[model samples]
Target chain A: MKFLAEYRDPELAKQYLQEIKNTVTQPWSIMEVCGGQTHSLVKNGIIDMLPKEVTMIHGPGCPVCVTPLHLIDKAIHLALQENVILCSFGDMLRVPGSSKNLLEAKAEGGDVRILYSPLEAVQIAEANPSKEVVFFAVGFETTAPANALSVINAYRKGLKNYSILASHVLVPPAIECVMEDVDSHIDGFLAAGHVCTIMGNFEYYPLVEKYKVPIVVTGFEPLDVLQGILMVVRQLEAHKAEVENQYARIVKEEGNLEAQKMIFEVFEITDRLWRGMEIIPMSGYQVKEKYADFDATKKFKIEIEEAEENPECIAGEIMKGIKKPIECPEFGKKCKPTNPLGAPMVSSEGACAAYFHYSGLVEEY
Target chain B: MASKTKPVKMQLQCPMPKLDFDVITLGHGSGGVLTNKLLDSGVFDLLSNEVLDERHDGAFIEMNGKLAFSTDSFLVSPIFFPGGNIGELAVNGTVNDLAMCGAIPKYLSLSFIIEEGLKMTEFWEILTSIKFACEKAGVQVVTGDTKVVEKGKGDKIFINTSGIGTIHPKANINKNNIKIGDKIIVSGNIASHGMAIMSVREGLEFDSEIISDTTNLNTTIINLIEQFGANIHLLTDPTRGGVATVLKEIAMATEIGIDIFQKYLPIETQVDSACELLGLDPLYVANEGLFISFVEASIADDYLKYLQSDANGANAKLIGSVVNEHPKQVIMESAIGGKRVVSMLPGEQLPRIC
Candidate 1:
């Protein structure tokens, strides 16, 4: 509770809110590029408390929300195999694939287990020698180190029965994709703090220079987010675009070097198709050749197929900051958390779910 | 000489049967010697009362004019947790249910669905906890039944308890009685029982130990009912889906809106950290020992003071109030001065405190 309590201090949060109100001279739009930040903003009502000059857009920072439909299909297919034990983070259990979600597969006799860490999946593989255990390794750069280490640990132990269905995504490339979009009018960005904690703030400097947008690496607490907005507003008002660190306590300019080293050694950059957005160049990671034996897609011989996104879902536009969740016609009516039509509605960090969960007075906004 | 030594070694390894049987079998439910031995040595011996000792098929107890009957089944995994276990949970669950109805719980009927391979030592421990809980609640387990399922069919143990209590004549607690100006008072801290269970289940270790806030609320609830009577509009124990879900139910049932203030809601530091780590909202977490009461706004302050005087409701506070606006909705004024709807939980809460 050391860092948590300080960041949630009401008095401190008011100071930041007042600073942001004074800093903003004109209307500016900023996107928080992490689902965790999005949820915190909505749950704590930080979005509504911010000065009307600043509009907060939710980005596709949720790894579970951006995981492609085809990948979910492949995961479900692999989970249903007679001798396979599919392990995934709990959030992915309810994410609907084309035909069925992992939870449905579990109820239908698939050996699916919810694991907190990929290393736990490796342990399960060690315990159940006869069953092939595959972990659904999906997340942004924040989770890359842990997923990479699981494979490294498995190889060190010579765990042949263990593999991971990697859907690892990178934050920088996705940011570039958003900036490159012709219709995008984003003025600043709140970079995910945990992602910066792993990969460091060095990556955001290039994006700031390229897009001329102030990027503040932000934490997930209410005050952290308000303080982050203030930093962005100050930079924007002064007509200066630079990378700032509001979450300096946790994130450093040079992040965990050992973690970066481990990730690079096991993963290679590749073009990954986001669920709603177009494929961004080198926005995803694939298990390196040496670790191919530990990659579930290669081991299981899964055939990748092009799948169609539901036209009714505006998640792509929403992720790019072109549209808000409330703008979608199906937002609260046809689509909801219980019966999610898109990944954003299913993932806990997804912008749609956040809006839906905390949407009463928000309707007026 | 070797045979005699072998017998001695076997005796040393096996040890004495502190219980009649070392492990449970189907014969324990067959109404035979094994069944009698289990009851006589375990259940009846620990939970002995005049009514229970009578050994009748049904309990013939004397009750006043209005009686409240409620039953609940407990199947929480990792049966034993930091503050309590399935046995105490089973007893407290029904007792609280009856208390929510403004009844003073007096007698309970205990039943068990035990797995065949369960150890007698574990069963005895559970029985003992049940006895202690019954004594604390001032209720007696007058009659009971037991069934044995195969190893794979059941978890280690499951308990079902049905409680009967006398309802006070002045008590008129119901959702319909809730008025627009009613105040919502929550007893003690929220989200502790849920976070406690979740921490143990996920093997999460915090700086300080987080124990379940599972306790009997019969006495506290009865005392409040005696003092306030009809002024206490409604009472409910927030169990499966936390305070948010219970509030949603009340809103829908009465067609009134609920507005809760964020700063007033009492939450423990460790439970808050656990919830934050797991990306879970404390509002949606489960509670076992806590109850939320809707009381007349005029006497709400006095009622809160009375609740705070009791050890069980030491941290009690006025969390929210009933409103005519936003009918059938529960909203919270966030600490940051923003308002949002506190929706009911969608589905099962998954473990994610990684």
Candidate 2:
């Protein structure tokens, strides 16, 4: 409550909104590169309140929205197998795979459990010695430290039955890939605050310098988002492109050194494919060879076949900011939260789900 | 030929009760001595009244002309929660349902479907809670039934309550009466019941204990109807789907638009933090004791003041008002001046990694 109440203060938010309105001079498009920020913006109605000159484009910060279809299929395959207990975050339970989602598998008598943390999965493995326990590890850099520590803790305890289905993604490379697109009209960015809290703002300076884009590390609160937009607007108006910190209370320049070290010890950068988006170079982390025994893909001998996205879903274009969720013909009619045709419609932080859940405009579209 | 082997039995982990038979069995429902003992000593003794004491097949009672009849089943997991248990929930739930219909609940019929392996002490405890709740709500359990199933067939215990109440002649509380200018009033804090269950079920430890806001709303509702007759258009308890779902239901049912201001919504600090930590939205979290009222805008302030005078409605506030635009939709104006639709929850609220 200490941090939450102050950030949600209406008077303070009004001040930031006024500041953002006064700072903007011309039309500029900014992207919030975290699903949490996108959700806060939509839920709080900050998107509609912004100055008309500024456009807030949603980004690919939602890890659940970007997890490949094959990985979900593999997780479902492992979950339904005999003597295997599949532990995952609650968000992954409803995400549809190629054939079936994890919830369907669970209904069909799969031993699937929703865990708040990966460490709880390790504890489950310790308790059920006879059953193979696999944690569906997926998320951005903010989650890497915890997932990495789970493997480290398992190895330290010499737990043989524990492994993780790693789908860890990095934020910087994805930003770079977005910046490389010639059709993208992004002018600035609002970096995810929690990810910066873990990995620091050091990785973002290079992107800011190379792309000449102002990046403000922002928190997930109404006032924090308003202040973040104001900062980006000020930088854009002054023709300055630099990395600034709006969430200075939580994030630091160098990040958590110990967490970075632990992450390096457990995982290595590799080529990874985002669900609807094209494969970005060195955009994901794989369990290092030394921790191969803790890798679930190897431990379970999962053979993943190449899968294609639904031809009707425009989630790829939506993720790149080229199209909005409302622009898709099947948005609310065919693709909805209950029967999601794409990951964005299912994940809570996804742009499509955020728009569908919060904006009345979706009905008109 | 191989010899047939007897199946091994599983050892129950809980300590047995201090009774002749530690665990409940099918004999408890056989209408023999065990059934008589269970009724006379266990349930009837705790919840006794003149009608139930007559030992008749059904309760024969006199009621006023117009009556409201409603029934509900309680299948909440972990029958016991932080602030209350399923027994109190069952009573309050049915009582609130009747209250929502502008009726004063008077009599209730209680029934239970218990598992064979359940402990007698646990069953007694639940019965005691039901008695306490009925006494507080000024209702009597006039008739009831009990059945037992095999251990694997049921959970520990499940309760069903059917309530009958008298509706005030002047009260016309129905969704069809809602108009464009009607204002919406929420009773108190939201999302405590669902979060309390989640905290216990998921082993989520917070700095302070989050208890369920499970209490009877009949008295408060009756007071509102008595004071402001015909002005209150609709009364709905936001139970399963929280405030957002109830608002959507009203908007769609009446073909009216609802616009609620987020800043006026009352949510506890701890509930907000817990929801944030779990990636949950407080708007969609369930509340056991909260209800939303659609009243004429001219008298909405007076109604809010009247409600605020009551103990249960201390935190009552006017959250939103009906609108002509966006018919059949609910919109929320954010504190930062943004606007978005507050849609009904698609499924069970799950924690996200966003």
Candidate 3:
């Protein structure tokens, strides 16, 4: 609580809000490049407190939101197998696949477990020698090292029953995709602080240089987010497109090298399919050939034909900051958390879910 | 929720008595020698009172005034947790439900559906706690039944407690009674019980030890009714769906608006940290030992001060108030002066990938 309480201090947040109000001379659209940041902004009501000149755009930073549909079908298929035990993060259980979600499969008697760490899945494989354990490894760079380490831990223990169905994504490629969009009006970005804590601020420098947009590494706390927005506004006002770290306490320029090494050791960059979005080249991580024995897709010889997203869901547009969740035709009516039209509504960190959960009914209340 | 009490491991007052079997078997449910032996040895005597000692098929008791009856089944995995176990939880759950109805809990009927392989020692621990909890609430467990399921058919143990209580004479608790400008007062901290369970849950263990806040609130509720009377418009506990869901449900039902302040919401530092670590909202997390009261604005301060003096109400705070501005909506103003809707929980709050 030491570092956390201070970051949530209301007085400090007020100072940063005033600073942003004074720094901005004209209207600016700034996107926070993480679903966590978007969640904080909405949950803490920071979006309303910000000066009218600033508009916060949500990004496609939720791994659960962007995990391809076909992969979910495969994970479900694997879960239902006779000797397979599927383990996944709790959020992944609700995202609908082509037919049903993981929770539905579990209700139908599939042996599925919700675990907080991938290493626990490895331990499960160790405990049950006969049952095949497949971990639904999912997340961005913040989770890449841990997912990779699970495989490393499994291999060291010679766990023949352990494998990972990975859907790891990178933040930089997603940022570039947003910039390449013809209709995108994002002027600055508050990069994900936790992601930056792992991979560092070096990755954002090139994005700033290429798009001439100021990128501020932002923390998820209320005060940290407010400060991050102020920093971005200051850079935009001075016409300085550079990478700045507002969460300097946790993130460094080079990042955790050991974690980066662990990630590259077990995984390789691949052309991954993002849900509702087009395939971004070299944007996702796949298990390496050396870890092929620990890859569920390769081990089980499972093949899933490409599935399609719901035609009505504007998740692709929403992820690119082209449209808001409320702009979609079936936001709260047809697409609800109980019956989701897309992964964005199912995941807690999804832009659609965040907006649906935190944004009030009356706009001015 | 604030940490007014630490998790204390309860000690069994009486040791497990000698039994024919070390572990329960299917024969224990057959109502034969095994069943009688299991109960006669320790269960009946430990919870013995005039009503329970009668050994009748059902309890025959006398009631005077308007009564409240409530029943709840407990099926929490990890039957035992840091501060308490399923035994006390079952007792407190039904007791608090009756308390929320502005009733003084009096009699309880207990039942257990236990797995065949459950150890005798564990069952004794559970039964002992139930006896202690019943005594503390001044309620008697009159009649009961026990059934044993096959090993895989059930969890280690499941308890169901049904209670009947006499309504307080001065109480006027109803959702319709809530009026605009009514102040919302939270009894104590939030999210402690849920986090305590999560701390010991498989694969989600954290370094810090959080105790569950699972205690009876009948005494506090009865005292409030005795003092404030009808000024306390409504009384309800924020149990399963947490504070946010309960308030939202009330607002929607009564067609009244609620505005809560984040700064005033009472939560312990450790519980807040755990919620943040899991990417979970404490508002949606479950609480067992807390209640929300709707009182007239004039007596809100005095009510809070008086309630805060009680053991279970020390961490109590006036969180929000009823309004006519936005009917059917619950909005919370953040510590930083921003606002968002405190909506009903869509589903169980799940941990995030990050």
Every candidate's TM-score, chain A alone: 0.97, 0.98, 0.98
lDDT of 2 at A263: 95
Candidate 3 per-residue C-alpha lDDT over B1-354 given as tens digits, one digit per residue, 9 for 90 to 100: 001122335566568887778899998998999999988988899999898899988888999999999999999767888889899999999999999999999999999999898988788888988988988988899989999999878888999999999999999899999999999999999999999988877767776767889999999999999999999999999889899889988988888999999999999999999998887889988899899999999999999999999999999999999998988899999877889898866677888887
lDDT of 3 at B93: 97
Model 1, residue B326: what's the lDDT? 94
* Candidates 1 and 3, the one with greater TM-score: 3
The worst-scoring run of ten residues by lDDT in candidate 3 chain B lies at B1-10
lDDT of 1 by residue, A1-365 (tens): 68777777888888888888888889999999999899889888888788899999888798888898989998998988999989898888888888789999988878788767888778878977898999999999988899999999999999889999999899999999999999888999999999999999998888888889999999888988998889899999999999999999999899989999999989999999998897889999999999999999889977757567778998899898889988899988878877888989887788888888887623311
List candidate 2 stretches off by more than 4 Å.
A303-305, A362-365, B1-18, B26-37, B54-58, B203-207
Which candidate comes out best when scored by TM-score? 3
Q: Write the residue-wise lDDT of candidate 3 on A273-323 in tens digits.
A: 889898999999999999999999899988767777889898999999999
The alpha-carbon deviation from the true structure for residue A67 of candidate 2, after best TM-score superposition, in angstroms, is 0.7
Q: Work out the TM-score per prediction.
A: 0.93, 0.94, 0.97
Task: Please report the candidate that would top DockQ against the real structure.
Answer: 3
Give the per-residue lDDT of model 2 (tens digit) for A1-365: 79777888878888888888888889999999999999999888888778799999999999999999999999999999988999898899899898889999988878888878898888878878998899999999989999999999999999999999999899999889888888788999999999999899999989988999999999999888888889999999999999999999999899889999999999999999998998888999999999999999888877767677888998888888888999999989899988899999998898999989887655432
Positional deviation of residue B264's Cα in model 1 after best superposition, in angstroms? 1.6
lDDT of 1 by residue, B1-354 (tens): 000000100111112236646899988888898888888774786888899999988887888788999999998766777788888899999999999999989999999999898878678778878888998999999999999887767777899999999997879988899999999999988999888777656323244478899999999998998899999999999999999888988887778888999889999988888887776789889899999999999999999999999989999999999998999888898876668888865688765412
Instruction: State the displacement of the C-alpha of residue B203, model 3, in Å, after optimal TM-score superposition.
Output: 1.0
lDDT for residue B155 in candidate 2, whole number 0-100: 75
